[model samples]
Target: MTKTLALIAAAVLALPLAATAQSSTDAKPAAKAAAKPAAKPAPKKKPQVTRRAAKAVEEVTPIDTSTDVTLNEADLAVAGRVHTGKIQCELGADVTVTADESKPGYFTVSTKGAKYRMHPVESRTGAIRLEDPRAGAMWLQLGNKSMLMNQKQGLRLADDCQAPAQVAMSAELKLNPPKSLFEGADAPTSGPVKK
Candidate 1:
């Protein structure tokens, strides 16, 4: 009888421990679920900034307009040659160069969505060069063609640009190509010799 009583006491003591272990195991998952709710989807991101946006910002940015850049006679002469009005380029691109009446030797060069304030910059190669230092843009005008380049980006914006004079010059060049210096002078005629 005593052996049976001790057995019953052992079972009673073990019952509580087993119940607590089961409860703890059940509570862990519930606590975890409550502590960490389902992660909400990440919020959508804003659109990426664009080059056009940056350019727009640049337009609004204040810059000093008082600094007068004086040009000499040569620069003025070059400016006069700079073809104003719409000039066409290859790939159907066009640029409009308008001289500033208020500011001689100054021009506003525009294309598509961009505009630059340019001034004649003397060129050692005899090409007409207009530059907008702030914008890092340069316009090079040759006798038969012209090109606009972004010095900062190291890329050509427009090429083969032709004004009326340039168009005429190009046609003339096609009709009468320049003589090559390498070829020898024409041989004297067999029967005729200069006295």
Candidate 2:
């Protein structure tokens, strides 16, 4: 029984070495098999794209500026608050500010002395070209509202002029603001309301 056990141990130890030796021998054939010839690539067929006729692009004519830019009063919606001395009114105009919206027929309005580029209907744009020939008045469009500030006050109203307009911020004999943002138009009244 002792001899049998010793024989079994020796066989177990030798079995590992024998298995390793056999693997080494087997690896040679595997290595040779790995040295296989390169496979040939398949040929690709050519695309059958046919050429079509060129498109006929016509030149777009420029808008006629010779005449007045037709402004649609129905489209213009004034949405802003206008205050003068003790007078105030809410201008509910829906203006646009989206890019790529070419609002033709829209005229830039100038009231009192302020100016801003009037937007077209459905444009959703906000631009105040507050430079008009009208004196004693200021026009500005904030967001979607067109505000017209005047220099007139009633009995009950002290003043409703907007902030000292930048254009006339300086120049003492400046116009009296109806609702002066700094103070009442009378705060820096150079003289009586000229008109």
Candidate 3:
């Protein structure tokens, strides 16, 4: 009877240990499943555009490929009033650039007391461009107006302001002239004398 009782007790103790071992083994698989990384979703493919839709879109936007534009001397002449806002200078002043395109291929630019003679140079655009190498200045003519830029000083004067009245060269001369040489009657005479 004692032998049978001892065998039963041993089996009872082994039952809890076996249950724990089985539970731990089962939990290992669950833990591994939770730790596994999820698979990535497949990349989405772009929807194909119908041929009719592409043709309709192309018809809506037309491309211009004409290259017949030309710029001539007349286009570059600074004839009309061209003015700009206050120029950023040392004294912070406004400047007026007057161009006389009377002479082809050559033009005169006047601002304040300074005058620059410019000549046309090759430009890649339709705008007429003139340059004064001496002063390092450039004049870009756009339609009826022009802009003056100083390359050396890195200054730009746009043709956005209202130009003042055109100053006549003759009027300026009339206003200010040199002192009269023949002030008195003792004027020097130069001529061929007949004996």
Candidate 4:
């Protein structure tokens, strides 16, 4: 009878411990579920900075820059025979524009155009050679710079003067007082070349 009672006591003690362990195990999963995060999707990323390789893909192809220009008769009547209306130094094929410290933000180049408005420099001496053909150059003191013109390759004032006389020369066909000033060339001849 004592052996059976001891056996019963052992079983009674083990039963509550086993039940407590089982209960804790079952409660742990619920607490763990609350502690842990739900399944999360991946985050989207922003665009990074563009590299040189990416810039290469974005870049346009290169192109040829040189062009040969021809002059028309109407282009001739312009002041000083220069392509630019403003009096600026135009660089020749051989010339280059360089930066200068004394005159910052401005450029210095040696070049010239085909024609010029000659402002004769008068002194005790007579007219010197304004058009220096040895250097194929002419000096034009134009806005904030001096123009050193090359006359060898293209047309110059000297070249234009040397044009065919019939096309180049200008003649004034003046009429006599007896004539009406408004009369046509076929009306009358009162002077030398016109007559």
lDDT of 4 at 146: 28
Deviating ranges (above 4 Å) for candidate 1: 1-68, 184-195
Please name the candidate that would achieve the greatest lDDT relative to the true structure. Answer: 1
RMSD of each: 34.4, 37.7, 41.7, 43.2
Q: List lDDT for all candidates, in order.
A: 0.73, 0.32, 0.46, 0.31
lDDT of 3 by residue, 1-195 (tens): 335545544554465588689888898677777778755644655433322222222222222223232336454443222333333222333344444456544557655555566666554333445667777676664433345666556655443222332224324545864343224233446779555
- Name the lDDT of candidate 3: 0.46
lDDT of 1: 0.73
Clash-forming residue pairs, model 3: none
Ten-residue segment with the worst summed lDDT in candidate 2? 50-59
Candidate 1 lDDT at 27 equals 89
Better of 1 and 2 by lDDT: 1
Highest-scoring model, TM-score: 1
Off by over 4 Å in 2: 36-195
Residue pairs clashing, model 4: none
Q: Where does candidate 1 clash, by residue pair?
A: none
Better of 1 and 4 by TM-score: 1
User: What would the per-residue lDDT of candidate 4 be over residues 17-76, giving only the tens digit for each residue?
Assistant: 886798888986777786777555446444222222121221111111222323244322
